[model samples]
Target: MVKKLISVGSILIPTVLTILIVNFLFDIVPLNIQGLPLVLPFVICPIGAVLGLIGYKMNRDNLARAGMIFNIVLFLFPIAFNIIGTLSGGV
Candidate 1:
């Protein structure tokens, strides 16, 4: 049961991070909103990565791999955006 919960978290964390990052990128959520976008991607990404690794080690193949991939993309997305934004002169 614990392992199952961890597996679920491995997927959920990155999924949520992706949603948050997208919202941040597009300003879909109003900045007037308080505390919603305060989440730290650095913290969440590592947690997702660790959980995904655990899930994989525990043989939860699909969920684990999906979580790992999502975590990677989530971690990279912001850096990529920053690079693009810089190249585009803060687009």
Candidate 2:
């Protein structure tokens, strides 16, 4: 269980957090910081894809399981974010 958790975290944590970090650090829409805006959403896809390939090569079983976990996260996070945004009047 622990290894599975760790494996998922190894890939998902970095991929998702880096997406958020780049957005926030670059001061994307609604952010108060001064910097370049993300004119395109998929601009960061290469980074995530490279990391995903690395994760895939690390261990097939681990990567597969981690991917399932990440998909669940991918499904849930947006709903949660939407709810929060709606409540906060940002929607």
Model 1, 23-58: lDDT tens per residue?
666888756644344345667888898898998899
Distance (Å) between predicted and true CA of 88, model 1?
1.1
- In model 2, the runs with Cα more than 4 Å from the true position are 1-60
TM-score attained by model 1? 0.80
Every candidate's lDDT: 0.76, 0.50
- Backbone clashes per model, in order? 0, 0
lDDT of 1 at 46: 81
TM-score of each candidate structure, all chains considered together: 0.80, 0.38
Tens digits of lDDT, candidate 2, 1-91: 5544445554664466546546765556465643322222234333444444455566556574555455444445545655887899864
Deviation in angstroms for 18 in model 1? Answer: 1.6
**Residue-level error in angstroms, candidate 1, position 71:** 0.4
Clashing pairs in 1: none
Best by lDDT: 1
